[model samples]
Target: MTGWRIRDYHADDVDGILRLWEQMLAVNADPVYGLSDVLASCAKDHAVVAVVGDEVVGAAIGRAAHAQGWVVFLATAAHVNGTSIGSSMLAALESRMAAVGISKLSALMPAAAQARVGAFLQQGFALKQDLHYFERHIPVQREELKILAELGGRVLPRGLWDGVGGMNAEKDLLERRVVMPLAQSELADRFGVVPPRAIVLFGPPGTGKTTFAKAIASRLEWSFVEVFPSRLASHPGGLAGALRESFTRISELEHAVVFIDEVEEIASHRQGEPPSPTQGVTNELLKIIPAFREQPGRLLVCATNFIRALDAAFLRHGRFDYVIPIGLPDEQARWAIWERYIPDAAVDIDVRLLVEMTEGFSPADIEYAARKASQSALENAVSSGAEDPEGPFIEDYVAAISATRATVSAEVAKEFREDIETVGRL
Candidate 1:
């Protein structure tokens, strides 16, 4: 017998799953789902398929709402019908649903389908003859998301923002300017408040501008669509057309937070004798921004390390709602970053001393020093053959701090301060 394995469904499995669904219906089972419905369910919901080599031998599809879960489709190949495939597939689907906080799982099938109903019974599903299954279908917007995915856009997990350690001011600004307006759209509209459509996050390198943009998406519970200039450069219409098409598809989503990092690559100032090559792309972006702003339920976040390099018109009043700066971490932020990097141990390490010593370090710089300290401690422990090695000592951290270089130089920091004073719009 060929070895079989269960795994998450992929786009490639669509054909196999369709064939499997056809085979099940051929056996006089109820035919309620269309091909598009099945494909959409597989795309946006939790689905698993059992495969022997590349051939799908069994499958289960599920979705969760509130505290209830529904197994929309389940099937096994005729060759493997009597084997444990059916029960195993159900178990896998239930496990996935349970992970997402679904406590009740129910299935619907016609009374004549004994074999299909038996599979559910074997997997602990009770027969509810007293109850009836009724569903009012909602139109699936998954097709729009499918197009977005093909354009390299994705819906990121909400947990990402929680991982951002510090920069409380940046976080607060994002919440008030972006998250609050969108999340409380009805409330804000009632008070005659208009939600911002575009914002710019400007700062020195390694200050977590991109991180804040992603966190805003997470906080708003919206889909994230990052337009990659390099990826779009290969399109037939070139970079400018690719960007326009990407935004066109992105507008299909009900709610989205679009991001363009290192935006100065295309939006830089057009001054100089020969004129810049990116001037056309800059003009295209400016045109796209106004149209994007006219639409509700979307926000554009652009991040740049050198805000001064951008074209002056790009940062003008109507183009962006806010131009916020994300500077180097303060003492409290540094302490948070330090404490996060240190592992839990029986012995306490002096993190305040480490924080004080690395006053000029960015979050990334501090993380590097912490990793270096842990690495050196581990190497020493292994070399010395210490059985009960204690945690990284303060001295270990001190040595790492002395050796580690800060990413932000004093000169660059001074320049950043000047830029904030002169050009900052927050």
Candidate 2:
């Protein structure tokens, strides 16, 4: 009565096929088809399915060659049990085989499914005897292989340090404090008798520590590994495993730069309180850092907002040898920062004046000033009802400069500078 419709196999049919296969195996003691075999057959063949409305009541799996007969998977839903569905599905397959000039038909069925095999035999098909199946056990090197269990599957693109506005002194400090030792073979040999020192970049918020870390990595043409502290705390025991996997992956690259941003979040010491979940994570990192340092061609750069809060042990000589402070951008650097922000804007404004005005401002502060200045220019153009409203004038910038205040207070900058000067003598 043509109650069922048959069509070629679609990729969407895989879940249905697998569910049916599993259901049939549960109903009957034996299953003629299995998930792996079905998948393998689909990989090698042009499969087809028999559908009654939206549901797959039956399926035919087979592969064809030029002269030889085709081997096919014939299966039907267990719910439609013993309704000649299997026979009909096999007949449809046989017709396709005959159209392809195949002289015989064959399939792999369990020895216990003799009734099903006899049904196929009745359809003018015979089992060939000469095929012998064998399996081999090939041991893979566990040490050399990397099985990355995605603790967190979200992939962020490796951040490039190209857009940082201005931090010349910080950049210069990093180049001397971190990059130079690693770049020179003699210096590396003289310093440790083996490897270069690991440097830590510490500063207050918005001081461009992460940006500086990326710049050092980029300048050295090293592979960069950016680790977010939050991600490290996501899993309970996964931090160590993830770190090991990451280290293994990084080792493949000749020169790798591993950057830990906001390092204090993970490695900071807990004072006047009990240890929390993240306390264990920092301890694990402390253990790994030494091993990481032992490995050649690897540079570890850690950035943090609060350096004083970090574990005293973590800041010791072997692990994070140098603690380079990334303070507020200096006066000349602020001027350069201003120039960067107002690239094409026509301004008779003195850069030194802008820099002096931004005395206690960080690099981020200077950039914000530039943005505010540009916005002021646009507002002035609009208010004046100028013919070309797009152009920002010098007066707009001067007004913007006059309006904004320094981000860091003079008292705070002086106190910080005093602390640095006192610490420098030690």
Candidate 3:
């Protein structure tokens, strides 16, 4: 308690610092800054130690950025005069850092270290009340940035899931089956629930399959990379080789949602005596899936308008966790779609009537019709030399509905229902 001296840290003080750090951890379950960070700062930043005859008893570490200074670590052995020792070490650290024009000194002491508060308060440090610490851990790390750029992938912004309008049924299914497990992976593992690594989104053309894929990525805050089969066709290694290379690069990413739209083109049934032209590409993809599943923190979303045309082996249980149906929008879904396209200025528009007329319309069909209605109305307004600030009227919408052809036929809708019953896993 009596023979303690405080001075600037030296290279030999590392062992003394380690001893104090381990002693603090033995008592407190949590320490804000990691041992590595504290040790690194001790070597490169401002630091001081209190020793009893060359045996270290206390230490204070700090760093300054701009005018603000942070007390990264403060600790003293139990046998020493802790409060007096801590205050002395802190004062020494402040003096060492004072040369850099530091205006304010702060300590991020965790709740477990409340006993050490006396040292800070005694050094004229005020305890901040009603203040919360907020931090966002970025999903992509620095090393993965180059790989993501090469793959033309990016982390999508938030709110896309809500912006999807309706399709609540599809959204609900994906949220529970795909998103919940992956987002809460630890909890899922506790319950022995394995998150889906890959899934097939199947439906008739223009049912927003691609939209759902991107929204899933956005919802999970993972990087999105869409692999285009047509683009890969021109690769010098050929489509199969290009497909293999793309996935190999994808493996380097820590977290990603890889999308392949119109997958039927590359994954069609491999049959016939001479073997189909895309058979090699299909074989390459089949091999890729098993390897992709082995790696964690990745999801493969393959969308196909013609699910029936896909190879039977590709849809097996181990390869894809779910085979979901993204069919035409139902009543509620159609209403949401109309709501999305309707301009805020078009207050007089009849949404109910428009929804009724757009039944059996694919989401793409609804969007196309809405755009056409606005265009026709614009032409009418301009040609007549009159301005209608209220955008398109209900009549304009009705006319557009009549003119627009549904992307999905009645027959296609019936088949999709049948496919869901037979092939759907969810």
Clashes of each: 0, 0, 0
Root-mean-square deviation of candidate 3: 16.4
> Which candidate model has the greater lDDT, 1 or 3?
3
lDDT of 3 at 419: 99
For each candidate in the order shown, give its overall lDDT on alpha carbons. 0.79, 0.63, 0.87
**Clash list (residue pairs), candidate 1:** none
**lDDT, model 2, position 421:** 55
TM-score of each: 0.69, 0.56, 0.70
Query: What would the C-alpha RMSD of candidate 2 be, to one decimal place?
Result: 20.4
For model 1, the superposed segments whose C-alpha errors exceed 4 Å read 1-141, 273-275
lDDT of 3 by residue, 22-75 (tens): 888899648889999999898899898898898989999988877677888899
* Segments in model 2 whose C-alpha atoms lie over 4 Å from true places: 1-168, 186-195, 236-245, 271-274, 382-385, 389-391, 402-405, 410-415, 418-426
**Weakest 10 consecutive residues, lDDT, candidate 2?**
132-141
User: How close to the true structure is residue 106 of candidate 3, measured as C-alpha lDDT?
Assistant: 78
